[model samples]
Target chain A: MNDGLMIEVENLTKRYSGHAAVSNISFTVRRGEIVGLLGPNGAGKSTTMRILACYLPATSGTVRVAGLDVYEHSEEVRRRIGYMPENNPLHYDMRVREYLKFRARLKGLSRRRSRERVDVVMEQCDLTHVSRRIIGQLSKGYRQRVGLADALVHEPELIILDEPTIGLDPHQIRAVRQLIKSLACDHTVLISTHILPEAEMTCNRMVIMYEGSILAADSPDNLQRFMSGHSQILAEIAAPLEELNECWAQMPEVEQFDVSPAEGAYHRCALTPRDGLDLRPRIYELARQRGWLLRELTRNRHSLEDIYVQVTRPEEEEES
Target chain B: MQAYLTLTRRELSGYFLSMTGYIIIAAALFLMGLSFVVLLEKLQLEPTLMPVTELFYITPFFWLILLLSTPVITMRLFALEKFSGTFETLMTAPVSDREVVLAKFTAALVFYMIMWLPLLGCLLIVRHYTNDPSAFDLGAVGSTFLGILLLGCLFLSLGCCASAMTRSQVTAAMISLVFGATLFLVGVLSSQLPLRPSWQTQVLAALSFFEQMHDFARGVIDTRAVVLYLSATLFFLFLTLRIVESRRWK
Candidate 1:
């Protein structure tokens, strides 16, 4: 019994009609942790989440949710997890409170308990005002909230949301993001999204996937630092292009740099070291020694987008 | 048992709360009332022949309404959930696939029964307006309703099975209509086929819902017809469960 562990997926693979939709991959989400499955469309993020939620069977792997085997004990796992599928499908004819009450009852909550949970979740998801309104009459944001409320009303140990903010407005997106972030203290959340910044801002850790494979998994900060070798330093040098090039070739410390026209007689050069070191100080001193006036020097570290594209692009090409 | 009740209630409400249920009910009552009026005029012409109770089962009107209402009542059972994308929410709700299928099947049956419920009002109107209390056979009425129940179970099960096979309601209705029409037509056309064997006639009699209703209207209960309808209903319901379960793995 791995204490405080919500999910453990090992060598998970899902194939459809001889075509692999989710290749062999392995990852785990600990208790009360907010983990994001970051990938583009058709990257199998939903497949992984579905397998963990016990909505789909893994082609040839094992997924245990809340310490129960997904295949062998799927009912137990399903009881412990709340799954909000993509597009936030809802029963539009049902009212907000009625739908949540039904979902609570369906999840095995007693009538009194279901009522209490429905009230609490309605308040938590900001659905108090529209509790009596039919779901079809509600706006998209409200419907999304209804979906979230439905997932949380069960009070499951783990909540899996697949693109919960797909069709929400900016305000609704922020509200949903804040709602998901607030869930971290009590619930383990596995969120799948293609939006890079949302994952970075909302998730405590990320499992980056591409083309049915997991490329990397780490915190947003650690991912940037882990791929720091790919970082580039930009220096605006006030000198002639040929002089900057000639001086650059003379120094072994400067490995490869691109020179472009800068603002009014200043030439911009981007320098990247082969060894992935902080070349800012060395380049500044070299600039002073070479009699070249430097205007701005900054390091461009990798963001989630850079890391996402960098990790997923090569495999996309290979599959094509 | 609680899970089954919850699902059945949800499904029942899904029909009642939507326009589909109301529209089908209203249409069925109107059509049955029209058929009642036509049967009354026919009785005026031929005074001492058929009982007033025979209008429900002994006429083609009964089979026509069954063929039309069964598909419409069941087309949206799973199709709307698939169209609106609630299959995920409904399927993952900590209930077995069998519970889900049974819930839907039972809900459709209840609504199908509701649609025919207003026809009883027609009988009361006929009793009040016409002085024909002696012409109504109480025993035949009970058996007729029993036959209607069994036949409804069979038709709604086929409709639910067709709806389960697709996400589009139109396609579901079309497939179910085709299946119901084929069965009804085959039963009606059974006599056209030249048959010498007693077993062939028995087989045709078993499949003929029209003849079955006629026998039931006269209070003659055939265990064979009852068994066939019950078994066929169970067979389609089992097929529906398989389809729902196959969706998870496939």
Candidate 2:
């Protein structure tokens, strides 16, 4: 029924002047899902997020946020979504508490309700320590936190953050990442970032784009599973590797295997799986029967980084 | 209504918090105080000085201070938001652009009024020291301030519209100066035009802010003058709203 979806975008496009900033793209975020919109620069990630936040209108196509059409019911949709734009601009002249209170009011909270929310968000974002500190005088990390607290002061159902951890140090990045992960308990969080590792660490599902188009949208696990060569096995074996290679090549589980003779009557070996099955058991069984001593056996699964690069690779030919 | 008040309060507090507000007020008061001293001394020599009828406080130099002061007070109204990238955050909030435009307009208008507060100090000083008990012309004083406010309303809106046109405060200030000076010159030069008889009414209708202020300083609050200033303010405020909305397209 699409009832559990928090965002539904179809054929959305945004064109500036004669150029299309965001070509036709479509994706969805289910309720309570931590979705990441990941892409390189100029890949329309910000434009798509802005459209979904109701900050910018799409050139064509329909987007619904919280079951409300972004174009026709923008105000209502805005109320439902807390959007932190790229760089997370804030009123630097204001104190953290003052800024949050004002933002709460602007988001349609009454004075008493706004005060309560100011405290709640400050506590949630861990901004209570700097609640009375001037935003301009705070460190960059503190300012980023204030921006996030301001976004959630109204207690929106969905939260959208654009590059939430763009300029943070390693420690601050970790803190912000944990804060985002915690938010998914009550919020449908959509984060847009070119920082691939950040997205992999935080998002449950990813929308990877390249050249103004979505190349893939799936869970991180599913994406890695979808890659044809997802894992590699490495081993060092003794006792005449040529005989073992002949037997391994005939095994059904071994997709391909390479063996190179090494010093002291040993061989370096590597193998890939043909099916989506772990070949460690079969390899061990075959080794026991063949009387070949297995010295080292290790398997490495494909990471999101590999799949991200494999899917969103830039074209060899540049766009004119 | 609460939303409007919240925006207005934020804007007003922004002035008191920023350096531009203090600089504009100081510059305006310095020039105003200079004129107040020079004019008071000059009129005292004539032995026929009245606190109210002395148009020195509301003379050409007064308009000069206004022309110089407007750009500073209103230059950052919208341009700063655009420059700081806060406009996106603000526009995406539940509030409408109309509320934003009005709130800023009201804040600039209020700051403009604050700049004129020093004029009151000058007037009260003139009245207290003068020998004649009937020296103060309340009507002239009231009407002159009214004239100042109406003119301030028009120029501040012009400055606001200029701010909306760009993301640079310096450029916004330049726009305010260009438009403010152009309108002031138009108002002054229209009367000097060698017009045919029928053109007199058209010139008076279109360009008479300078003329209106002259009459008001002499205790004339013409309805025509009031209507022109209010409409010009609304017109520019409306233009600002449109510019803000059009930024989404750009």
- What's chain A's TM-score in each predicted model? 0.88, 0.95
Pick the DockQ winner: 2
lDDT, each prediction: 0.87, 0.85
- Candidate 1 positional error at B73, Å: 0.8
Report the lDDT of model 1 for residue A38. 90
List DockQ, one per candidate, in order.
0.56, 0.61
**In candidate 2 chain A, what residue range of length 10 has the lowest lDDT sum?**
A311-320
| Each candidate: chain B TM-score | 0.94, 0.93
lDDT per residue (tens digit) for residues A1-320 in model 2: 46999999889888988699888888889999999999888889898988888778888989998888987887888888899989889888998899888888888899999999988888988899988899999999999999899888888899999999988999999999999999999899999998888888899999998878899999887887877465878777886866877877788888888898877878888888886567888878877887888888888778788777776775663333
Runs in model 2 lying further than 4 Å from the true structure: A228-230, A317-320, B49-54, B193-196
Score residue A209 of candidate 2 by CA lDDT. Answer: 89
- Clash pairs of candidate 2? none
For candidate 1, what's the RMSD? 3.5
